[model samples]
Target chain A: MPEPLPDEGPPSDLVSDVFARDCTSRSAFEDVTAKWASLTLLALHEGGYRFNALRRRVEGVSEKMLSQTLQALERDGFLTREVVTAIPPRVEYALTPLGQRVAGRLRALADLLEEAAPEVERAREEHPGRAR
Target chain B: MPEPLPDEGPPSDLVSDVFARDCTSRSAFEDVTAKWASLTLLALHEGGYRFNALRRRVEGVSEKMLSQTLQALERDGFLTREVVTAIPPRVEYALTPLGQRVAGRLRALADLLEEAAPEVERAREEHPGRAR
Candidate 1:
């Protein structure tokens, strides 16, 4: 008898290719790297936090945007949203293992940017036309 | 004189903080990670490319979008633009040292996502309500 068919797997050709115009990976890349998403992931990297605490730590995210950002990250498997029964029905957000990995890498990038901030500012000064 | 007043450095407090809502680095982070910008940086990471070639390589970017993205990257000191004196005044774009550093990190994140694509798709399948 023929060997049992392999269980369901992502299509053999389903390689994530951001270079491809129609690749779904492009959307994944965007979801992961969007401004708020990156900040949210970094914020959660430290530890789980209640929604309001997360909002405060993330600095500028409004209530609606934070809610949407967390939901999107959770949907992408980068985070988990756990609701605990209590007086206020507390909600905590934390990174999944996958999210931790991404967040680690993002932190490295963020560190590099911080270290190079002085240089970047100088570049802006030199190119006044591009300064925001 | 006392150390010549340390010759014009970025303000001591001018740190790049993506977590800060009002931080200018927030703008820089956005410029770096925007969809087309990320893809464009990855495309140029391989090597320099002419205007039309770059537009093609980045896959889905419109001509105007590519131009604007390239300008933003150039202004950020992450890349440079050169206009060759030719019959058609050929233009080229390439990553600067700073850009190379960023591209390297971004590439790692991109690779991680590609490797995790199977899992992410699985998550979407399990959470049909969130599937886009």
Candidate 2:
């Protein structure tokens, strides 16, 4: 055979261009590190939930923003939305398997980020009059 | 004395509240992960540079956006901008020590991300026509 037909799309060069600014990893960077996305990913990974439940659990998310965020996540394939046939028509969102794995890793990073709080605080104070 | 008054301002619970979305780290999240900020930080960490030099090195950075990115980084204390009171007013920017440490860590992460590109690509291919 001719090189086994080279499976899948060409490999991503996220690493090579990751620090280069114009690299493809920028998309991943933007997605994973956005304000509420990682946290939202964590919540969805737990199980399926309705819109109201996510709003309540996410803390400080406006309905408009939550809906927008969910749409973005769903677009990225990190989440799957299902609509149940009911009187009012219920909709629920949950993590796909890939999202689950990514969320698990992100959750661990979140834990580390939590532990780094004291250091970040000190850094902040050390530079008091700084900050943008 | 009173233990030096515990140094300065209130301790930031960034790590603890990181997953909460409304936490202070949200600011950090917004700053660090923006499209060109990380790459800009990397370039700055290399050494001080005038505005145009950075634009040239970074590739695809608009002058307005570069200025904005620099201002944000300066505000975060990750960069220090010094204006030379000369004929054309030369201003050069460089990393503060703390910024160097952060850039170092982020650079490592970028490298890991680059390395993981193949896997991410594989995941994408496996999912086929997925991705948001």
Q: What DockQ, between 0 and 1, does each candidate earn?
A: 0.61, 0.23
Tens digit of lDDT per residue, candidate 2, span B15-66? 3665455554555545655667867877876788898998888778889999
Which of the numbered candidates is closest to the native, going by highest lDDT?
1
Interface RMSD of each: 1.6, 3.9
A1-132: candidate 2 lDDT, tens digit per residue: 455645777553323565454554555545655666766876776788899998888778889888877776665556778899999999999987766766766555444445555555555566645454
**What lDDT does each candidate get?**
0.83, 0.67
Recovered native contacts, candidate 1: 0.59
Please write out the lDDT profile of model 1 over residues A1-132, one tens digit for every residue: 998757886448656787765665666788888768898998899999999899899887789998888878888888998889999788889999999999998888888877777777777778756455
Instruction: Output the number of the DockQ-best candidate.
Output: 1
Q: Say which docking band candidate 1 falls in.
A: medium
